[model samples]
Target: MRRFMKLSRKTLGLLIIVMMLLLSGGPGWARTLTVSQPNQQIYQEANFASTPLGAVPQGAKVNLIRQEGEWYKVDYQGTIGWLHRQAVPEAAPAKMDLSKMLFGGPVKETGSDEVALAGKGFTPEVEAGFRQKNPGLAYAQVDKVETFGVDQAQLQKFVSEGGLNP
Candidate 1:
């Protein structure tokens, strides 16, 4: 009976140690996200109008620190900044490079301009073709509207005047 009791206690102690080892890694673990959008700017603040701290190209990995509304606070290449949620896919799967795994070497890097152009569905060529088809389209008005922007202070004042939550 004494020997059985000793063995049971030892087994229980080992189990507790194993469980602690497993759970110890949980809090420190960070979720890594790959940048899906090219020229994704890491801003100082969550707002787009804020100064850009740096930019991460597509396929770059960022460690998610936390999320605030539509912004994600991330650490990219040791620099901590905020990236818009649009910069990453909703549920991006980890991409494995078989060639890199087999043979250790750097992967071919894609230019930021190329990646940005690829993501744009409506290219200049496409726009020209559309304009040719529809000559009466008001492109000048569209350009004028695109130039209009509200500054942060003005936006806040407007929100407060309307009694809307900022």
Candidate 2:
């Protein structure tokens, strides 16, 4: 009878330890992301707390370290970069149709700059970077980003018009 009680106590202790481990390990598995935007840049030794410093180009992948609302914390090479959640693409279902999704949502287009901007899904980070680097223009002109809606040929044409390398 005493031996039975001792074995029961050991089992219970083991179970408790396992439960504690499981409870403490909840946050171990975190979501990671890779860059899907074209010509995006990752800082050499900085972090992406809310937004990435420069654009992370298309097909450039990274692991997501953390997330806060629309922003993501990511690690690439030895550098940490913040990327917008919308910019991150899932592993499966590879392609995206930007034109149909962007301007068609709720907001009606009056053919204004805001409408054009809305259709492109352009972020302030991208605009600011281009503005700082590419001066001598009234504004940064994005042509091919709008072609994200169509097939590859249209996209290629758009990129060419905008003089985008990719």
Candidate 3:
């Protein structure tokens, strides 16, 4: 207490600044980010077709080593991998403020509902009505087909081996 009181104002201010910098993860310090998705897939490379190196459950902390466009290179559970930007929240999204932005914030947010509906824009009411009208639509088969995906990494590997590169 005596030493702190004896310090000049300028010195105290400089000490405070240095402490702040240290706490703020200054240069060469690996910043950390949290996985926000229910499950986030980390790829070996940054692409839709890259091999999935592993997955991180929601709310997992990861050391963010670097970022490239829509992907972040992270250190997760003792492994280095690349995670999609959307799979993590850089920070919680800013709250919507009505009377300050166009259309007064959002009237409706699709959110995870969009994924479950497969982009068909189906509200629960709409889905229920559709089901009532089309009792034999085979929605299960449609959902299965919608989930199919072609691996792009495989195609890249194929091209490299077949001399298809220009």
Candidate 4:
């Protein structure tokens, strides 16, 4: 009975230690990610519109602090900042022998238009297609509007006058 009690206490103590270690989230738990894309900017905030803190060059390693939406809070070169998720490449999919599958024969890899346009928000081909379908629309006026730009001073003045946050 005494041996059983001693064993139970030892097991309980070990379990508690394991639980504490997991909950503490020490340096061993830190996940380091490499910056895969060039011209990656670390923003003061998670948003792209926010002022950029610094630029993290390609191949630089960053420690991931946390993630928010499409942004990741990272510590790069001891400077904590928010980096876009696009800066890191996702894990590659598992390779499989398609030729050995039930379908038989070697499979040739092909890319569809949908796959090409998957992550592309707006493309020239989409614009051309839209123009073709709606010829009556005044695209020239829209293009002219896009060409308009406001100087920094004027933009700041406008924002101040409108009581908007910079």
Candidate 5:
């Protein structure tokens, strides 16, 4: 009876340890997600208006800790942070290709195609066409503007900092 009691207690203790380990995600499988947005903001709290921890660029991998509605708790760069579900995907999303999808290859000098897509009246092609129409037009300065770009992030800092002002 004494031997059986000791063995039973030992088995019970081992079982409890195993259960605790499994329950705490030690042996459990972790669901990892990849940030799909060009910039994904990590929030200090689950709320969007909360302080931002930092930003994670597209294709960055994050361990899914837990989910609360539209917000997700993720472990990114050894830091626990909250990210909106829209900013991440189960798998990395394919980046958008404007030249291929919008322009359909080398666009014409008059970039009417970009204007149609961007709703902006100006593109390098449009400027070039303007220069052609009027050779005296000094558009070289304006052409340099198109080279600059900014990343739009779905994060608290982005929201507070005026969110991707083009």
Candidate 6:
């Protein structure tokens, strides 16, 4: 009886450890989404199970928080809603393209520079300055600029230029 009790306690402790391991450690299956269509309206609310919560033009980006069957739970404008999986790109945390999230619109030249040139027009000096600032930037003009993690000032400038707000 004493041996059996000791064995049972050991088994219980092992089981608990295994359960904790399974719950705490694993592949993070979170999905990050980028709006794949041009002029796609992301509604402020989820009108339907598949209706885009808001319009994310061509390159709007978001992070997937949950999955409801064929739809995705995404963070949009400080709110959550469902978007069709088809509208979002492949789910992977590694390839999250935040160019739009970083700069506002797509990673196009006009889009990226627009924020810096807002209320004004793009000029040679402006372009030169941007080039000087981001020497290694992929393009001379960018519709999007990904700051990788986050920068409030950069985000604010991007938002001021009508970039997607996080």
TM-score of 1: 0.41
lDDT of 1: 0.76
Residue 4, candidate 5: Cα error in Å is 5.7
lDDT of 6 by residue, 65-130 (tens): 655444566776676776665565344322223455336766444444423333245555788898
Please estimate how well model 5 matches the true structure, expressed as its whole-model Cα lDDT. Answer: 0.69
Give per-residue CA lDDT, model 1, range 66-114, as digits (tens): 6666678889999998998789855332223434543687656454434
Show where candidate 2 strays beyond 4 Å.
1-32, 39-55, 89-166
Ordered list by TM-score, greatest first: 4, 5, 1, 3, 6, 2
TM-score to native of every candidate shown: 0.41, 0.34, 0.40, 0.46, 0.45, 0.38
lDDT of 5 by residue, 63-151 (tens): 87776656778999898989986685343221223344335895344534332333234655787787788987656666787666655
lDDT of 5 at 41: 93
- Clashing residue pairs, backbone N/CA/C < 3 A, model 3: none
lDDT tens readout by residue for model 3, 31-141:
678887875888999886999988788999988776666677889988898988777644432222332333555445446542233324455578989989999999889
Query: How many angstroms is residue 139 displaced in model 3 relative to the true structure, after the best TM-score fit?
Result: 17
Q: What is residue 78's positional error in candidate 3, in angstroms?
A: 1.1
Better of 2 and 6 by lDDT: 6
Looking at candidate 3, the ten consecutive residues that score lowest on lDDT are: 92-101
Mark the 10 consecutive residues where model 6 has the least summed lDDT.
89-98
Predicted structure 2: lDDT: 0.57
Stretches off by above 4 angstroms in model 5 are 3-7, 89-166
Cα error, residue 12 of model 3, in Å, equals: 30
lDDT of each: 0.76, 0.57, 0.70, 0.76, 0.69, 0.59
